[model samples]
Target: MQVAPRRTGEWWISPAIPAVANAALASLWAFTAFGGWGEQAFCGVDSAHDPTCATGFENAVLSSLAVVIPAVVIMVSALVLRRVRHYPDRLGMMLTAAAFLWVGAEGIVFLGGYLAQPS
Candidate 1:
């Protein structure tokens, strides 16, 4: 009986990709949580007594986690697949690629929302 050789084309899905993705997501989450972008909007309201603007600002900042949480999950899954033995290489690569794209999309959406808001 002859054993088939494993494919080597999936070398790009290394452990570093997930690790870097995790870091990127963490940084974005921290940036939003700390009001890096939303602070301006929060403070731009002309009326100091109006509560609606403050609430909108709060919601915008909090809503960022909607993207961060799933990105974290995907990052963790990719990391786990990279570490575990006998995990399918193609599946791991696909997950990592998808996660990377998702994170990119999330970042774009976050930026768009921030830019689109009235100052």
Candidate 2:
């Protein structure tokens, strides 16, 4: 028998917290990737090898994975808890997991591309 949720309409809270956390992490990653703290900026979205940007593309990509990976792990864990373990307030879990997974996979791809580029 499945237990009813404790709160009447608070299922949003679980996903909201993770979404906000991911947003914050994304912001930080963007800042670092764009040279927010005196570091050279990475190439822009429209130009992957812009002459003005920094040459350390791999480093920027790696750092972004540092942010994306953890958020993905957390969201995946929450999804597993809600689906397999039958945790409560699971309303937004799937969406949250999907968003995180998409972002994380993109980060991995970006990292791979930079890593494979000629030095």
Best model per lDDT: 1
In order of appearance, the predictions have TM-scores of: 0.49, 0.34
Q: Mind giving the per-residue lDDT tens digits that candidate 1 earns over 55-88? A: 5545655565566566666656654664542464
Q: Specify the highest-TM-score model's number.
A: 1
Error of 2 at 107 (Å): 9.8
**Candidate 2 regions off by >4 Å?**
1-13, 38-53, 62-119
Distance (Å) between predicted and true CA of 91, model 2? 5.7
Candidate 2 per-residue lDDT over residues 1-119, each given as its tens digit: 23235578532345555556556656655565554331332344544545433345645566556656666666666556646336434535544664665467446545644554445
lDDT of 2 at 72: 62
User: Can you list the residue pairs that collide in candidate 2?
Assistant: none
